[model samples]
Target: MFKGLAVLLVFQLTGEIIAFGSHLPIPGPVLGMILLIVCLRFRTSGRLVEDIERTSSGLLSNLGLFFVPAGVGIMAMVQTVQSEGIKIGFILIASTFLTLIVSVWIFIQTRKVVERHRETQ
Candidate 1:
């Protein structure tokens, strides 16, 4: 776990450096995640990567526990949230509905592609 954490931090730091150096629109953490994903998708497997996979799996399996602090933070923001809450609520609702519609459209398109492949086969 410690080793895995160190690697994760390295990725994040690297991403931060890339962000500052390149002045990218995206966040460091996002780039770090992309880096990690690409590393995982590498064709060659090694002992170190295997260990990383184990640790990452363990961490991901307990992701909900990590969100507890965030949940608590939102719970603690009761007073501040009372003001300007309507605008936030509207944005959240609109974005969620937009995402849902986009996801459904993507699903339908993927299904059509799959259906076409099936017919050709």
Candidate 2:
């Protein structure tokens, strides 16, 4: 688990360095996650993968704790939230719907690919 965490942190730090150096608009953690996905795609080490999975499962189980800071931030900006509540609500709804649509579309496409692969096999 420690090894997995170290790997995750190293990726995040590398991503932060790259993003800072390149002045990219994307968040370091997002880049780090993308990099991790790419590496995991081609990696052949089962032990490392198991470690990552174990660590990830533990983190995910405590995912709600991660939202506490964001909730606190929203409370801190209560006035701003009140003033722009409608716009914020609209954006959130719009984004949620958009995400749902995109996710469904991706799922359909993936299913088609899997079906085609099965037919070939």
Computed on alpha carbons, the lDDT of every model, listed in order, comes to 0.87, 0.95
Displacement of residue 81 (Cα, Å) in model 2 is 0.5
Per-residue accuracy of model 2 over 1-121 as CA lDDT, tens digit each: 9999999999999899889999999999889999999999999678999999899999999999999999999999999999999999999999999999999999999999999999999
**In candidate 1, how many Å is residue 37 off?**
2.3
Report lDDT (Cα) of residue 98, candidate 2.
100
Residue-by-residue lDDT tens digits, candidate 1, 1-121: 6787788888888888898899999999889888988887883587767667778899899999999998899789977678868987999999999999999999999999999999999
Number of clashing pairs per prediction, in order? 0, 0
Residue 19 displacement in candidate 1 (angstroms)? 1.5
* TM-scores, each model vs. reference: 0.71, 0.84
Deviating ranges (above 4 Å) for candidate 1 = 100-121
